[model samples]
Target chain A: MSEVQRVENRELQPERAANQAAEQGWRDRAIVPPVDIFEQDDAVTILADMPGVTPESLGVEVKDHTLSIEGEIAVQMPEGVSARYADLRGSRYARYFTLGDEIDTDGIEGTIHHGVLNVRLPKRDTHRKRRIEIQAT
Target chain B: MFRDLWRANDPLFGDLGRLLRMMDSNWDNVGSADLRSAPRGSFPLLNVGETDEAYNVYVFAPGVEEQDIEISVQDNVLMLSGKRADPADDEKAAGRNWYRRERFSGEFNRAITLPDGVDADRVKASLKNGVLTISLHKRAEIQPRRIDIQAA
Candidate 1:
């Protein structure tokens, strides 16, 4: 009897569907978008695939050196459009990254290209490789 | 190496990253760019919906060029195939080192069966803003009614 009760209790936990709001009162499900991060001589660029997201719905925030990116996909059914079915649903793409001290947070720049979000973080002056010139004595 | 630095930064980082990776792997059917070449997991998830007039299909294919996409219909099957270019190509042209990669690139093909009555010949497709929308119209005329040998 105790075993069954424990199992039932675990089921009642806050865990819920990915597309449903259980923990937070968010409207849509939050998904982690795929990303590509590369380091260059001057900056580090992060590219994320965020489909169905419009320019007005995308958000990028940096606080305490932790970069957060989120894009909410808006779904508005036009007249005569109904009986929807299939995998694509209304959801939000959210992802977070911890920035290292070498990154110059103030110098960050971002843009969206065909639903792909590209964010470039410039490196600090002290961290960038400096080409030392040889002195001929 | 990149994971180690992130793990050392915060204790919650490990669990958070693990959970996010798990989700991304499971829901990779749409907007995913998995690197593995063998499995070729589902990429650019699609949605086929219906209305009174026709059926509409929406495919999420970010970063894919229009010229790279090919669409065809045969035997009531709609085939969507395309290649999403790798953004790292630009990085490589310039001297750069990769720290992490998760975005999907390369070729992917997906096929969805149409209803029995759809007129495959009347299908129309268009690509805009990385999203491909295809409209398949239903047969306009009803099937000819069968008559007995003693037709009046």
Candidate 2:
């Protein structure tokens, strides 16, 4: 199996980047959430595991043959409750995938449930395989 | 002879390097990055903490539903079990090319030993944004009490 390619986002404004770095501490960095890609006859499905992210906090954008997914993790702490032990803290999750022209970008659909994001990219009709029948001579 | 010796050592060095990288990756995933002690299980990463009134446990399990999860406390041990469904069979049968597959899917179970003061009967669990937050209320006798200072 081919290794998953990791891409880093480089479009963040310097000021905002600095502010985010400061807010999340130096050790906390944007993590690439694990994903599974499945191909069907007519569409490709992508599932991403992003814990602590709500539907409202997820952003999916496709531009210039690139599909980008970003999820913001909001750790809401009830008032007066402090952590005595912690493992999974809040952090941003981001990933990107390059799409081929055969994909019908306009027909793309995405849904988020239980912190899992599923994206379906339908193939263009022209790109789908068609069975040609042989004429009896 | 020297070239032959070097070639013989090449795999040994390569194996050592690979082993180191494996250890590093495991540490990154199972060690301090988790912000807790070493992981007890492999599937869902967990965080456990305690407050004055309750013990808090957070399970990071995405793509799972409350109905799919099972939680029970027995003998001061909290057991969690659930299954993460895989993609539809039709998709798999279509023979799609996979560039990468990292997400874990299948049955998983984790057992955590509760702290001494936890009140099993009062434990409450809720699923939000794919994270399971379990609150184990502390026993009334074990909860901290503020002592009143009398002015003499």
Candidate 3:
């Protein structure tokens, strides 16, 4: 029984290694940017720092209550100039978030200022916390 | 209309065109609504600190006048409120539609909870440019004291 268990372990190691490599590959292929989420008592505020996005270039879409933010950054190469630093060249950002049922889609508001996208997702009125006062006799 | 007719089948393109037109027209037509009615809260960055002498608080509120801001401290909590009104002449000015408008304006409020031992009565605030700096003196009891260790 020990020999059979050792053979099974050896066979599973390669599959596990392959799965990790595939998962890493998928992550590397993704282009979604990072977002900061702050959950408050009344609503959840999402701040997505998209540095090079212009007001005209930003796009927000809500479908099936899933919010999606898309933006493009243009890094134009100067004419008659050989490029030296090109780390941020041709970079664009896209992000999608599936909101929970507790979120009130109608109450959601979005604002874009100085390349930062601020999204306010208000919770349902019933889901919001309320204080109850008790009378002392 | 010609471009709209050309892309009538492409809803996405049509929507983009409509959005572009709206953005372009906003500069000349945006006064139909006031900033207070717009639902998004203002973004204000604040910094608070404490020292042996006093507590310090700073707020970044650019493009706002010193007269518009109000600062008060109560119950150890500092409240900063301000309103940046749009120019009255903006409503009548007409021009080619704007491609983009990104500046933020109107009422904003920020509250800071001060740690215990701060002297709220001695708090002083100053606004320069867009930065509002406040100084709060600390009570003598909260100041640190160094005691000499004697050989026993």
**Candidate number achieving the greatest TM-score relative to the actual structure:** 2
Which candidate number would show the highest lDDT if scored against the true structure?
Answer: 2
Q: What TM-score would each prediction reach against the true structure?
A: 0.69, 0.72, 0.38
Encode model 1's per-residue lDDT on B1-152: one tens digit a residue. Answer: 11211221222223243453455467445554423211222578665566665777788888887899999887556778888887666546467688778878888887666566678888887765556788887776632356679868
Candidate 2, CAPRI quality class derived from DockQ: acceptable
Q: Please rank every candidate by lDDT, starting with the best.
A: 2, 1, 3
- For model 3, residues B58-118, the per-residue Cα lDDT tens digits are 5545446678888988866677888755422255323313222333456887666555677
What is candidate 1's CA lDDT for residue B2? Answer: 15
Interface Cα RMSD of candidate 3: 21.5
What lDDT is reached at residue B138 by model 3? 76
Q: On lDDT, who's better, 1 or 2?
A: 2
Candidate 2 per-residue lDDT over residues A51-116, each given as its tens digit:
888878899999999999999986565555644433343378889999999999999999988888
Ten contiguous residues minimizing lDDT sum, candidate 3 chain A:
A81-90
Stretches > 4 Å off in candidate 1: A1-27, A75-77, A80-85, A131-137, B1-41, B141-152
